[model samples]
Target: MNHPSGLSAAAVQVYRLRVTHPTDSVTELGCRAGLPPEVVVAAESELTRLGLLRTSPAGGWVAVGPETATEELVAATEHEILQLQVALGATRAKMQALSAHYMEARSLRSARGDIETVRGLDNIRAVIDDLARTATTTVDTLAPGGGQGEQALSAALPNDLRVLSRGCQLRILFQDSARRHKPTGQYVTRITAAGAQARCLSHLPTRMILYGDDCAVLPIDHERTGLGVIVVRDASVLGFLRWLYDHHWSQATDFFVDEHESPLGLSSVEAEILSQLASGRTNPTISAELGMSERTVARIVAGLMERLGAGSRFEAGVRAVQLGWVS
Candidate 1:
């Protein structure tokens, strides 16, 4: 049996045995394997760091503490295997789909391809308008890096708000970094206030817009800096985007503007302070943004970091993102 990481058969056996008998001391494990105690100890330490094992009070190793880690590792390995199978499957699927689409597009391409010129802002607006008109059930979007201009925002928001008004669902995903922007918060607040559901993920892929099952828009130009290209009428692409959205949505927390205003909780200001730390913002930046002194911000960030069991800002960000406090 080949290990996923391509470890030798003997090494795989050693790893499996170590995982199964985590309470065994290095001396015992080494004795069983006819290896040196130091080697076993080093291997156990490496596994523990990789999150495949947990260290015991007696300094022995056990399998990961949470059942989820074991399950996740197994699932990840299975997913890789399945992905290989799916790639083989998709060769046939793609050939059939491409042949059909190619024949259909041939005539249109011959007739209209020459007439098509540069796609500008107007073209983008037209697409957005078409999306708004066609959306029947839902719209899911992920926006990152804060450069979705005013016009696009206005067009998308009104239509989305209208859809929400008429009982259609709208869910938007934003990165945790967006929370640092006042304008972004205001926009999110406005949309959420109008009944559109929205949440923020700590980290996400490039920005995208999914309109029901009809269209998926991704950046064709500069994904990091410029506007994106929209892929319309592509069900397969839409399905992929939907799957990606669901995966991130599962990891994201339900974001409410007033989440901190619960019957028993911190005030909004305190919550924002905690959220800033969670977003990987430095105390000085938080102080500048929130209009507080750096010292106060440091104290607040420090207290929240301690409470969250985070040793560093990055860990705090991960925890906060997991809990949906900041993003």
Candidate 2:
């Protein structure tokens, strides 16, 4: 039962049976080892294929001649071990390279003299221009409200387009409101067609732009006036922006607008029903207010509930709020 080379106890038992009872068939070997006959047969076949055992018509199954079986088993095991070792070495090398890159980026950012707070539009624009000029690898951005105008867009768009044309990766996140704007949606579509990745979220946090690891462009005005804020050679600030983007990205829904269907543009009766539901009116009250029969109102409510995937009137109202139908 002791396997020095880490083979399973079952494998060791099967090997021992083959060596001890050279004339035994697979069924007899299985019985001796208290294993199922099928398991013993499979093991025997594998061993024979690996040159660890020999089979003969007259002798049934037997260990390979002399030390050949032992040598073959040892060689196979060593080959497997060497493969694992090589894989481990490659994995370690990759980890080390990534660690070195991260450390070097941190060092470069730390060495940049005096961290400056962007207080106005000019300061923000200066930083953005510098970051855009310096970006070599990729850039990720989330701009809400179609705020990237013709000039800014004209400048950044070309660089982004160039990057896409050359096969560098760029991902942009936008707010749902921005998609309703024709120009913004057209820009997104154009860049997307050119191979830049873009998605729309139900909501986006404050406007921000990241250029590789070295710089970030944020809004100076909380209301996103033409003002911009820039952080140059600041790794910590860039890291914070990256984390915020990831958090929003995970929660944002895919940006597929179904033009043929409208969930919130309900009919007159449906609109009345939803209004009553949002106002916490019971079905009977809703029926009286709309001058509809109780049975009819109940059916309409049921239909709306099913469409919205809600379990109750309260839940339906909550979903309406989420979908921007109510409040």
Candidate 3:
């Protein structure tokens, strides 16, 4: 039978035998319980661990009352739960104070028309649509993560086309990892076919959407994009952002099938993976960062090792560096 207190049947049997004969020896307990001496000893040890048994003054085993043990266990569990609730309450209080400060700062910025915060997915999309509609010269974006979700791609298509139709140049930059994502590749190809400029780099510093020269939208939280966004209209900030964009664009490679291979004949994904490996990142970490499966990462590593004529990952990394495949 299953035990709510997590006692094994042997332990329960041994415990019952001990309770009935409070001064019984291990051998006697074993005989009465129909178990070997070793099993009885094991069950006794388990019972002792759970506070169901104790050593008497005469060195014989003693049985602890189940009600007493149960009361102690419940007290300990309640104490732990109360401590956790206290910690949670403290954290909530601090968070509320910080949130209030942030709201005040945001209101001040909004009053000056320098920054506007848009919360939630729906509101952010509305702001993006409005900005895209007003864009006159350029709509440049940097997508930092590997792949855009299907829903995001679908939602952006209409806004992208609207900008392009109004004679606004649409340029997008993505991380090298996105090149291996089939949906992202197809989306880029489709947009490029419709007069959009697309490029990719080994890494992107942030996610941003710049509409014209003065207006830009950026995520409020870098690691959690769905939380909200902040639109910046300050010329000084926009200038720096534009400069950052141009810097990455100058170093970025064109988004095309033919451009997938580098001068060393390594695919962008392979090169990025090799670089990460050489920097002492494990396959799992590389897979997570690149948004690829661990199995896919292993396969790619195996292929790279064979191509580089290396026997192990360390040797592959060394050879790749020597051959300038990674720095």
Full-model lDDT for every candidate: 0.65, 0.69, 0.84
Top candidate by lDDT: 3
User: For model 1, which pairs clash?
Assistant: 22-61, 219-228, 220-229
Q: Model 1: per-residue lDDT, tens digit, 127-171?
A: 566566667788888775433446567667777777777676888
Ranking by lDDT: 3, 2, 1
lDDT of 2: 0.69
Off by over 4 Å in 2: 1-114, 118-123, 146-152, 165-167, 256-327
**Which predicted model would earn the best TM-score?**
3
TM-score of each: 0.43, 0.43, 0.59
- Runs off by more than 4 Å, candidate 1: 1-118, 146-152, 222-228, 257-327
What tens digits encode model 2's per-residue C-alpha lDDT throughout 30-144? 8889999888877776666667677767866667653776787799899999999999999999999897787687556646443546766566666566555556777788876
Higher-scoring candidate on TM-score, 2 or 3: 3
Q: Quick one: how many clashes does candidate 2 have?
A: 0
The root-mean-square deviation over C-alpha atoms between each candidate and the true structure, in angstroms, is 24.9, 19.0, 15.7
What's the CA error at residue 190 for candidate 3, in Å?
A: 3.8
- Give the Cα error of residue 133 in candidate 3, in Å: 1.7
